[model samples]
Target chain A: MSTGSAPPILETKALTRSFSGFTAVNSVDLTIGEGTVHALVGPNGAGKTTLFNLLTGFLTPSSGTIHFQGRDITGMDPERIVPLGLARSFQITSLFEQMSLLEHLELALASGTGLTRKFWKSVKVLGRFHDRGMQHLEEVGLADRANQAAGSLSYGQKRALELALALALEPKLLLLDEPTAGMGLEDVDRTIELIQRLRHGRTVVFVDHNMHVVGSLADEVTVLQSGQILAQGTYDAVRADERVITAYLGESHA
Target chain B: MSEHLVGTSHLETAATAAPERRERAWARPLYLLLALLLACALPWFIYPPIALDILCWGLFAISVDLLLGYTGLLSFGHAAFWGSSAYITGIVAIETGMPFPVAILLGALAAMVIAVPTGWLAVRSTGIYFAMVTLAFAQMLYFVANRASGLTGGENGLQGIPRPFFGMELIETEAFYFYYAALPLIILGCFIAWRTVHSPFGRVLLAIRDNPARARALGFDVEGYKIVVFVISAGIAGVAGGVFSSGHGFASLNDLMWTTSGKAVLITVLGGIGTLWGAMVGSGILVTLEDYLTTLGFEGIGIVTGTMFIVIVLLFRRGIWGSVQQAWHWALGKARLRWG
Candidate 1:
């Protein structure tokens, strides 16, 4: 799928997943090159999130192969895959409800540093990660609210914290499901900026319904419809495709 | 914008100024010292046997709390560990003539060994399923202990289980002496449980408890944490059982009964679920009340305990210690505002 200097960082071949009799994700091929920001945009129930789950190893594919950094990660548990430099953010906020924002970042840092298994040391000793956690908070513009309980954060702020958590993992490939979902215009802009900042040296595959977010952030966009890719190209070219306009965007937008 | 900043900073200051670190550090140790003093003086106020009973049960309850309060893993069959340890400790003492610490250690080890497999099976399931599996395993152990009369004394139980000694007969020593002897084990058990819950590993357990799926997604081995905690909790429960057997000089079928597990749960809930010390508090209160009721010739003391448990559950959703801690924090918040 790539003839350039670096091979694709992640690739999927003939990925298919079915729930009972309903096929949620049909056989699909995907190639994400190193350091590329690829977007998976689709209308409601278009299997975008399903594909994300399959690629991240959260959901097992009925028949397919998932290759991450050229290693077969098919049916691997998400916990195992994450340590190999793949991390994901949930569509919904999934921060620890009782933990403060700083603690949430520290938990991620602990995983990355292999400190979570250290039973004898006090969590306070992981204060070594304090400055880095604060840096993440600052990156997400949440420095002031680092001490606040994560559950008390506003919806948009929670999404930002979720992004900070993913970033703290320092994954080689980042998967964000609806990184800016259900946000106000101002929050959308902030999240877009955060994504831009995060994409400097990382590979990213994100799912979003917002076309503008996709167009601005994604170097290449894949249009999915009814569990299959309808089109894949540069955002502008994909938007201009007649089938995408009719099947996804509708003639009104066209 | 300047005024807004001032207001937010004021709130933050008020929130963070609860108590100084030095002062907060002293609070726990000070409480521990006071608790030790009280445990020392308890035999003077109450009958020595009752005092010893409270301390033993207190350890058992705290062991249960390690799983229930901190990790959100509730076992309805904790008696499998406690009772099995009691029997092992008692048999070891009677046959091997080992010292007190060694016997207890062996018993606790046996309990932990059994916990490994049960925890393996139990942690694979969650919530009610976990509870049911534990209960089922405990019931099987209970029947096994019952049928193995040659080893466990069957339904009659292992009676006259000898206590450990330095050189002389320790069981023959005054109950007060034995009470003092048992106090350190209880305190040490509590300290171990406290330290584990405060460790970074403990934080991972809390993370798993709060959201297993999210914790797993964050690259934590959720089931692994659960099993390790289960083993630790079972080991502590075994310690409690060993102390109980030595103190009572007996190991019986009642120790392994499902009701014994229920009692541990009730004690934890009554005192407060998440607070580690709440288990001991609950045990003290429940045991004292039951003892007093029985002394008063009340045949159905269970009714009174049941009623009190209902009231505690209804009124104190956070349990006694949790509510008390909340109130303490609130008071500190108020004090900080007034002084600052």
Candidate 2:
């Protein structure tokens, strides 16, 4: 395990979330070190998404304490959480369908700056963000489709745009839910490369089913089954765990 | 196979290339100039009072469109702001004898103040719940106005709401004179709506409308934006209401009735939801039709308007202006293909 000398960027103590009477996530503790690429891997119904929801404050935990950058952020609203250097991407590709790709990045950029409150000014003021917006689109290889509407993009392209939007936030801790969930082989490779290039100084916690992605990019891997962590270590160490094999990896990778 | 693929791709590019160049026709300088000229000539064509009605209702409809079209909010209690502004303007004109502009401003301010609490409660809900909440608030205000007869003149309404002189004795409170005086304020209100939707703030509103969850994840205060827009819309509606009451020399309980709120919604839907200028077009058609039918001693105006609304919805689901915009782009694409 590469739990290096770096401090923890995010920590959760006894996080639990239940719906109706069924518990989706049950008393799980997690620590993510600063500037490390971490992956949460498991089979279907492993409660990985529920954990993400809890972390991002989309869903309030039934019982837990979440500390980010050494501050208590438990039960904070999603809108409030994002400004505190925590940003997340949805598992489903959510975007403004009628808005152009450049407009999407420009909006993300505008929200960070105080330009969103300038209702009286002409839209020409947004011209200042044009260069930076295009740079973001170029990062995802979508510069050519800058003016095109988000609804017209291919599925793989939409996934790339999603990453671009999250990256635009410049978060201290980034949470991505299934970055390459439905991508083809070529797109998967491209995304893996993009994440490798982008995760230089940021802490990234992603949930993925692809072992190949986990093997390549993740510095540390955590395996969860039935809402509890079964194992946590480096890629090879987690892969070699006996319970992980019997529960998840054995069936999927067999 | 490669040649066939290349040919199909070329066709696709041609089809998609046209729309990127097609700007909104209503926003063009030439069209705006034409519209301005038409506004200047309207009083000559119709009864001066009817012309004033068109201008006032146009501003009201545009205010409704600002929330309904851009923000994806459907408020059914807009009449609360409109009617409240009318009453406030009437009272100010009667009590202080302030300049008409000052009175109108105060009325608009009052409407914005009322919107704060009402919008705070209403924006917490979505879809039909939002509409119902706004409607409930309006109904409550209607009852309050009914009971407060000393202030509001109760069922008889506030009469003798004078249109104060504007320094020139020749410019009296005649319908024709008043129509010109009110035209600038209405235009200013419309311009504000246009500027709002085109600004960065407006871009965020569109994003919230399309996906509130995504907008919140992006760090936007979604409810805050809704409340702010709701207040601005109410303020604009108040301006319309102020002008309407002053021009008619009366403010009645009918101004605050739920049907007045419904009229704003109907006019917005009749023109086009998201198209800012469509509100004015819808307002013009509605006001003109009502005036014409009433002058002919016809009481079935609702049936005619209802039928027209159904036909518009069935034929042009995007409403009149939205469909026209689509067709304009399509025709431009066809022309480009044919010429080149």
Candidate 3:
């Protein structure tokens, strides 16, 4: 996070999203520094996922401005925002069941590069772009399973594919909502390694219930509680906050 | 180990191993040559009229499969686009001396125009709801075609459709040029479908169809991709319908019916929803079956097709092409195991 010495790459200003009478996400401002692994931690139903959804354009904010690289992107479609160097991965491994694992990466690579459609005689000629897809797959240690149907992959392998797809976006900022959810212990370690490696290219905002993951990776942490920011600062700083402990971790040496 | 080699590389693995990209480029046309053979040569061995019918429906299946297989939108209203184009082609060619190709182009354009609005509405709904909305809209078109006796000639259909061009006049029924002329267009149509399936955008369409949220989060315009596929597929289907009307010297409300739409769906399912070659196979089998049923004077081909659809859905979700591919992979795996 440049020791908090530079301007934020992504910032939320009074962002709020409401459905009918219920407000799932409330107006709460936060700044995520450039190249920082910003951890968003909260107990269940604490609006962590909702805030992720709003930020990534899955859900539009009802009020407030969202700035990415100093550009206002309050209510842009998730699809439109992807090319602007903002990409996300789902908590679940949302992938094509029928296609090869490599094909998934290829699609993501094509998308991230804005090569939406090419009416050429042979798509195989675009091997340069295809090579990048292979690189992404290799980064996740899935070069071997490149051709295997993604659906046939084990749960952990699918999670790797999900991460690979997000990375293929080549985004300036990445929002990962529960990236490690439902993964085995071994998978958690692999995914953590993948996230750590990704920090070289872009900032990552990841949510996880696992405090160990949060403490190990988060450059700074923001603790959410009941649709509001309970505490924010370094992992230790948020961990020591009385309000964070009382509201979320229940104060018993948590 | 064999599984790893054969795994997914069966489709385009050669491209990966090739040292020169230009050397690998020539391989693309071989697939087209084979498709041309199927469309052009096969009719010589079969009844010309029947072969022509298969070509028409094969084109239609390819069109529908482009959207359903590629984009993952199980559209039921493609018949609205197809049937409307037929009516336009039939009415125009008969009323004027416009060439058949020009009329067909008009039909395709009409379908694309309709597709944008319908696709816009359908894209908002996901999964089964999207399928239902498309079906409802198509049925609405079916009603309009059936009621518009003045233009479309209603249930009885418009007669005296002309097949202009093809070097002098040719009979719509026994025209040998149907095989020669229509065959090229049919091959070209299949080529478009083939290219789209293998292209970069085609890959993204499959990805979005598979996982919209993931595709979107990866920076893809999922909605835009779906709409684009829908419009393209609808336009292709319209051209197929135009070919059908001009070839038969008739256009009717029957073309716009729900049953007609279901026929294309049946072909897509039977062939393999996602596989391009499988679509032609599906179209061939379904068209042949319907023709046999007609000759037998069997009143309800629907009963048979409906049962087959249910059986395919339950027992073989991959359809014909998918199952064949699966079997081929299984065979390949077994062979490799034996070698080991």
Cα error, residue B290 of model 1, in Å, equals 1.0
Q: Model 1, range B1-340, lDDT digits (tens) per residue? A: 2111111322344344223323566687798789888889999999998998888788888988888888888899999999999999999999998877678878999999999999999999998999999999999999999999999999789998777678655444678778887777777778778878888888888888788878877888888889988998898899889988888889999999999999999999988998888887888899999999999999998899999889989999888777888798779978989998
Q: List the residue pairs that clash in candidate 2.
A: none
Which regions of candidate 3 are displaced past 4 Å? A1-3, A119-121, A183-194, A249-254, B1-35, B146-148, B171-173, B332-340
Off by over 4 Å in 1: A1-6, A249-254, B1-23, B170-172
Number of clashing pairs, model 2?
0
| Top candidate (lDDT) | 2
- Across B1-340, the per-residue lDDT of candidate 3 in tens digits comes to 2111122223434323312213236655885677667667776776777888888887898888887877877887778887888889888888886878888778878988988989999999987888898888889988888777888888789898887774454544455666576665666677677777777777777777777877777777778878888888888888888888878888888888777887888899888887877878887888888888989999998888788888988888999889987897678667868997
Using all chains and alpha carbons, the TM-scores for the candidates as numbered come to: 0.94, 0.94, 0.88
lDDT of 3 by residue, A218-243 (tens): 99998888788878889988888788
* Residue pair clashes in candidate 3: none
User: What TM-score would you give candidate 3 relative to the actual structure?
Assistant: 0.88
Candidate 2 local lDDT, B1-340, one digit each (tens):
2111011122234344313834667668888899899999999998988888988888898999999999999999999999999999999999998878788889999999999999999999999999999999999999999999999999999999977866644344578888888788888888889899999999999998999999988989899999999999999999999999988999999999999999999999998999988888888899999988998999899999999999998888888888887898789878989997
Model 2 chain A: lowest-lDDT 10 consecutive positions: A245-254
Q: What lDDT is reached at residue A120 by model 2?
A: 93
